[model samples]
Target: MRGVRGATTVEANCREDIFRRTTELVQAMAAENCIASEDIGAVIFSSTPDLDAAFPAAAAREMGWAEVPLFGTQEIASADGVARCIRVLILWNTDKGQGEIRHIYLHGAAVLRKDIAGN
Candidate 1:
């Protein structure tokens, strides 16, 4: 077995509208990476504290991922950190090697890490 990591971010117009968009972002990343809900070991998520519509993990649960391990936190505010945004680091199990793994930083988050986005 091997480990892989996937990441991504989504922007929300306001704190109240984050859940739907964030859910789309997470599900997109999982689908793009061909990750099975059961294959995901854990998912660590963060939202710019401004976002309070719901914990991004709540969206994951809405997607029918009850058995998956998940956690959520607030992203520290920085001059450069995107506002009203949600991000996640997915620790997954796969047979793929480190080089074969895909890390997804989508939506506005794409600009956050260009090096891996090309992959």
Candidate 2:
């Protein structure tokens, strides 16, 4: 099996907002890319330090991703990164080529990478 990488980002007005938006973004990415929930090896999520209502991973579990390995951390401040936003990096086991993998950068976070987001 080959490994595939996908990323998604969403901005939230607050911690509670992050949980909602992040969950939506992840689910949308999985659906758009046709990612099997079981095929996901691991997921790494990072939120801006300002967000503290809850771990975004908790939202993932609520979305029925209980068995998927997940970890959450804080994102270091960067002039370019969005504030009060959540970003995700998902590593999945798949036979698809890298070019076929879909990376979702949504909401205000779309500005992070114009090249990819524009498409």
Candidate 3:
């Protein structure tokens, strides 16, 4: 098994914005890493405290991940943490080596992991 990480930021605390950004993040991670829903064991999402209009996992379900287990939580408050951020950790059953995995970070969240963001 391996893990894929992704993060994105939204402009506001609204259901539509949250869902759109979360879905975009997940889709990008899947496309970049060649991930299929069936290969996913679980997905865990964390959002900054300022974003509370929707659960990021719900966006995964809308994106046809009904069988994949999903969870969501609020990120711990930190003075330097980025605001309106949604982060995801996906557990996947794959034979690929850890170094081969691609991590995605979009929008303002890109600053959080410049090494793995691949620009």
Candidate 4:
């Protein structure tokens, strides 16, 4: 299995905003990697301590990923880390090599990992 990573930031701690941005980040990662729901072993989501409006994984469910195993957790507080950010790690069952995997970082989260944040 390979891991595909993605991250995005929210402007506010509103449920709707979190859902929309998290969905966008997930969609971008899936589209860039050509990921299918069944090919996904599990999706792990994390957010900065500042965000508590909703779980990022809920956005995946809204995208019809009901069968995929999804989990969410709050990130340990970091003084220099991005705030209001949602991050995802998708353990994908695929033949793609580690170097072939594309990671996505959107919005202000791009600064978190400029090495892989083309999208």
TM-scores across all candidates? 0.82, 0.86, 0.97, 0.97
How good is model 4 by TM-score? 0.97
Q: Write the per-residue lDDT of candidate 2 for residues 1-119, one digit (tens) a residue.
A: 43433344444455567677877778877886888889999888888767777888888888899899999998888877677677888888888887887778777777776788734
Q: Which wins on TM-score, candidate 1 or candidate 3? A: 3
Residue-wise C-alpha lDDT for candidate 1, range 1-119, written one tens digit per residue: 44443344545545335666767767767776788988888888887867776787887888898998899998898998866667777888887777776667666667777887645
Point out the higher-scoring one by lDDT: 2 or 4. 4
Clashing pairs in model 2, backbone N/Cα/C closer than 3 A: none
Ranking by lDDT: 3, 4, 2, 1
What TM-score would candidate 2 get against the native? 0.86
lDDT of 3 by residue, 25-119 (tens): 99999998899999999999999999999999999999989999999999999999999999999999999999999999999999999887764
TM-score result, candidate 3: 0.97
How much lDDT does candidate 1 score? 0.72
Separate clash counts for every candidate: 0, 0, 0, 0
Clash pairs of candidate 3? Answer: none
lDDT scores for all predictions? Answer: 0.72, 0.75, 0.94, 0.93
lDDT of 4: 0.93
